[model samples]
Target: MAKAFASAGDLTEKKISFTEVGEGLYAFTAEGDPNSGVIIGDDSVMIVEAQATPRLANKVIECVRSVTDKPISHVVLTHYHAVRVLGASAFGANQIIMSDAARSMVMERGQEDWDSEFQRFPRLFEGHESIPGLTYPTTTFSDSMTVFLGSRRVDIKQIGRAHTAGDSVVWVPDQQTMFTGDIVEYHSACYCGDGHYEEWGATLDAVKSYDPQSIAPGRGDALVGREMVDAAIANTRDFVDSTYNAVKPVAARGGSLKDAWDAVREACDPKFADYAIYEHCLPFNVARAYDEARGIAHPRIWTAQLDLDMWEALQG
Candidate 1:
């Protein structure tokens, strides 16, 4: 794992990496930051997951410009994470799509999540003032929706509850490629702070059933071969399972949240020590797991103050 900020004055903007995973499908990833996907059809394009702000999204748009001049007609949000969906306005997309549950989450905790993520990752939110407001889906679905880009079929499905209650995957059956939001991460830390561990693992199983030849994960390099795709999914599952299970016993014993955090660290640090943001995400992950273990089905609202409080309580 590379240190996100190794020195005090390291202020270089992160470089975005885009890889063509299929004929017209591209995966846009940054240095363990939020990722976006692109599917170009004959007449139009569909983008998946916007960055934190318009300034950040333009970098992705520039990448798309390199490929085709077709208008980006649809922006599909895999879930309602502030870092992933707030940049929708920048694209000037005609239809912003999302799962019904994701739209609800946005209405429920969008403001709180926006504030919380801004605090956690200020670098990702460049030109923050340009963010008009919380992004809402112009089009939403209960289970799945299929859109055609000319003759190409792009199927967006709400697979299962993993990263959030409304986690979704964009499957391009023609190319046999799937863009898994945060449900799958490649060589990057899984941000399980707002995740449902048990359901997340099961969701990975559901994703595996697709047998995709290539996969674009939420972060890191795109998986090309079938073996690499499976490996990425498996690694994501292992990370979630270890984080949740490590904290579960302590949480069940009626131990303090701090104790549960320590238990998770002891169990996970050795295995996931090299992943990006491992240290930063642990406390929040433990806190969420603790709450879940205690029967909290929904993740609690995470405010900016709450983020610092938990960080200090667990890491200070």
Candidate 2:
């Protein structure tokens, strides 16, 4: 292969930051790694996006402990990705929630995703053995649901599809803060392997319509003020648009996947070369974009072997 497969060569530990985006609301970020959010209500706390393993989840728990002593009552997963859902067991929350579509995806390809991600990024899966198994949600909602943590009212809604088929966002009406899973990213590559490129813009629009004052994105730093929030959303949109638009033309002309990869690099590398996980996500993003442009609706499930084969083919 021309270079390391995905993030296998990335072994250095990242700097973790727990930033406050709103009153009693925090965003747990690790440089450019996947981020998690904390919503402390009057009587209890609600966690968004569990880390990859129990050990990693402990890091977020420690941050939660520093601010408040409320027991975690519920865990709301924004999506079904292994990196985000596998750590649910550590929270010991009374209820775990996900979108109805996310649960179905878990039943279909959760294990395969776990294996594929474990192989691509060894560092994120530290203490992988501790993961009880595929994380399943105890409850799910179709369109939107409201959970009141004591007096705090939290609104969870599936705005549209961007990062995944069942992507959802958490909104705190009082503070005008929203926790957008992978739908919006800041200074990090959006992993579009299972994304819907055509529908992502509408999803972004749905999120923007709220006029959120603060946002805890799926990856990158926490956006505090309205200026930062708007900037991050715009940046995320550009990243997604550049990737799909670059590949759509190639696929329309019956070009090979390699051709699409080169086109995307030419378009995106100049602007996003320094973005976190850019190289790791490029191949998969290009492959998915090409498939979408060719009329493939659902993303093909990725396995460990398929990951290696795709990397080798793209390198050649």
Candidate 3:
């Protein structure tokens, strides 16, 4: 029998947890669900990665309230994914910031991406009606931007492309804490359907340069120690590299996309099968890896129809 499309069968709700990884730095994680980071600056608060909807985002907001009553002054969207940015309205932040590349993606393919992801994972879209429509960045930066919440400093860089062309990370220099979106998952699947494989690894190198002591990943628990943070970076990088290695040889030998995907799945499954979103991300990750292995540079924009067609062709 063929597998279901993406996460269509995943309907159970996940438990949420908030961890204070450092002074005023918090990680809001929902078991294998989408994760968020809360940064309480001296005077205000900044939330990294809005949840999938206003209702869902409120959950994060509530978690933020638990520790600090500071206003959510800035909402940082590390990338332009529907599940990450659509809930920006809830925060009423003074500024919604994103990389220029991400802003461009929002204008170019935001709606289509929204439709595709909404259909792929219904559980994540539980409060779809709460979204006010496509969310746009109030402020856009080209490479890097620095913001201050009183005495605290948060540095955001449009580091090399990883999860998307506009992927970025939030760095807290004083506390040595980094909030990496989907770019560096901890024991969780890295969704690469829109990723740049080679550049993703290079971007991980940039992240490693920070030598962060505490790291908050896009989908997993907060890493409070240096060892855990390093392991998460290595784990994410290895997953991307292994996929490329397995798929590249097959593509070079003129094998079909399905052949390349099967090869990678065979090789990567043992190590990553139990990870969060592993099952749902596999087909899409393989599809993108197959294209990159065969020399494609920009990842093709995924649409609702593309999701079904590709799933049927590759999975069915």
Best by lDDT: 2
**TM value for model 1:** 0.96
- How many pairs collide in each candidate, listed in order? 0, 0, 0
TM-score winner between candidates 1 and 2: 2
Return the clash pairs for model 3, or none: none
Quantify all predictions' global Cα lDDT against the true fold: 0.88, 0.95, 0.91
Candidate 2, 1-316: lDDT as tens digits: 4889999999999999999999989999999998999999999999999989998999999999999999998999999999999999999999999999999999989999999999987999999889999999999999999999988999999999999998999999999999999999999999999999999999999999999999999999999999999999999999999999999999989999999999999999999999999999999999999999999999999999999999898853
Candidate 1, pairs of clashing residues: none
Q: Ten residues in a row with the worst lDDT in model 1?
A: 1-10
Worst 10 residues of 2 by lDDT: 307-316
Distance from true position, residue 112, model 3, in Å? Answer: 0.7
**Cα TM-score of candidate 2:** 0.99
Question: Which residue ranges in model 2 land beyond 4 Å of their true spot?
Answer: none
Model 3, position 116: C-alpha lDDT score: 97
Supply candidate 1's per-residue lDDT for 21.
94
Please list the Cα RMSD from the true structure of every candidate, rounded to 1 decimal place.
2.5, 0.8, 0.9
